[model samples]
Target: MNIRKTVARVAGVGAVATAALGLFSTGAANADTFIPLPGGEITQTLSDGTVVTIKLVGESANISGSMGATPVHRNAWVSASAQVQISGDTSATGGKIFPGYVVGCQVTIDGGNVNGGASGGVSWDNSGNATPSASANSGANLTLGPGQAKSFYVLDQEVPDDYGNESHKTRNKFTGNSGSVTWSDETIGLNGCAGYAQARSFVSVEVETDNVISWVTLWGQPFSLG
Candidate 1:
């Protein structure tokens, strides 16, 4: 009877262990490993004590591919929206605020014709010639490896009192009031790119009157592209 009891106890323990392993496997299979990015809100106080705030709304990406070439190339199109608000003691002197969206893209390829499995690169462009500084607007460029490429696109820009001139330097002006402006569905597209790619959205602001500039980037969840 003692031997029989011992045998029963061991069998029970084995059953429990098997059940626990099954549960663990099921949990692991059901768990999601992806993490989403956060929408961003940034505020900056100008030199003249003017408070400016920028907030990101919704952002997304659409990816496509072309099959004609020896090395398959992927295209990613990105879109985003944001709002900018200005307040605080603008009565002293009227100020102008330039607000716009910028999209930056980075791509990585494996054993492709581009980088030969080297690191990829990144690049940037602005729809409006607005820079963080008071000088001429200069875009950003980056080089990446492991078969990678990057580019930036400028989305819709709001110029408060734009007279529809050829000058790209247009922005929102606050004569003596507090207000906000929101943009929706600003889009940028990239083509003839290959490999895994991701895009980021940014809200660029320039306070012309106060000579202050700030940038708010929305690093929200990156979408996958073929």
Candidate 2:
């Protein structure tokens, strides 16, 4: 009886392995690169009144100068536009929230001054009289269930150079007569926060793109109050 049982188990194991091989030989298969323990999406957009959820993943990011002198690195960033809706407080200022790269990942948002550049934002008031301000870098720590661990490096800071670049920092619009050109609301750690100006607000949303992994384990479905 013992011999029979041993042979049966061996045959079953061989058969299972063979089946797995056959499946892989098929044309295509859906596979995940990293499996989040009870995981899900990352990209999120939050405003004074609304919240938008976007599918996102960690991607390598960096910033360097024309001479390669200044270099700032970040784990990842939001690839493109994320949806947003104002919260209950219409006048409440907003800020960008970035889930830094891997918890252990060390990163930085160069925060260069591109205030006068073509791509930089126009101008705005910074006289402390209700000016629009916000930014996103890359990190955050979330608690799923009781003790369930999920941590991401995040970059969040008060806008020091609203419309300025590393080249020329500190340009106040409300207080100064510089036409209040326009503040670069997008706080990109890689560009040192250099970008063509656009919409002005206190809230910002960040996300990651291009996972490039063999497996991606999703957490739970997104939970939003919006």
Candidate 3:
């Protein structure tokens, strides 16, 4: 149960004005919280040495908490934009996947597959339940081991745009291990706890598959940090 904490610079104001420049903490690139304000934005070079840009925007509406004297601090604006290149679980068994900040995602796999069938596939329930018989392709049953890797393009998967059951919003409650194809221009929403940025507030997730699951069961919102 590891939790990655997000820190605020609040830029001494003087440093930004005097030094003419300030840098955010260069830490793990896993699904982290990188909030830039007033004309601020975050750029990162991942473990693969690829550069990424993150945008943040404040809410237009002021939220009054409890309708009382204390006003809820405006949640800073944050948006992570990057090509979702995924891989690294083609071989490991009964493991987990994680958002290691900048290391991409560590996917988990198991020997489970379409119940009582040949060609052996991955399953979401290693407990010996059968997947929907209509499924066409198998889940992520591969890994890159401790060194190999792969990549994928990311775009938004909004429920409104979803033509099927694979939408991010629909999958949010599914307990089975799996991954999402984040569309370009998709809004991660706030708190990193749900919607698209769930991993943000999670710290880290633990992924495991022994009997039926093929993908992973995250451990922390940002596993490495968690």
Best by TM-score: 1
> Which residue segments of model 3 deviate by more than 4 Å?
1-70, 82-199, 202-226
Q: Candidates sorted by lDDT, descending order?
A: 1, 3, 2
Q: For candidate 2, write residues 1-226 as lDDT tens digits.
A: 0100000000000000000000000011122122121212332222222222322222111111212122222111121111222233233232222221111111111111112211111112222111112321222211121111112212222343556633321111121100101111112222121211111111112211122111111121111000
Per TM-score, what order, best first?
1, 3, 2
Estimate, for each residue in 13-131, the C-alpha lDDT of model 1 and write its tens digit.
00000000000000111222232334556565655566655554444444433222212333333334444566775423433333322222233221111122212111222222223
Model 3, 164-202: lDDT tens digits are 555331122213222221111122111111111111210
TM-score-wise, the better of 2 and 3 is: 3
Whole-structure CA lDDT of model 3: 0.20
- lDDT of model 3, residue 203: 9
Clashes of each: 15, 58, 42
Return whichever of 2 and 3 wins on lDDT.
3
* Cα lDDT listed for each candidate: 0.31, 0.18, 0.20
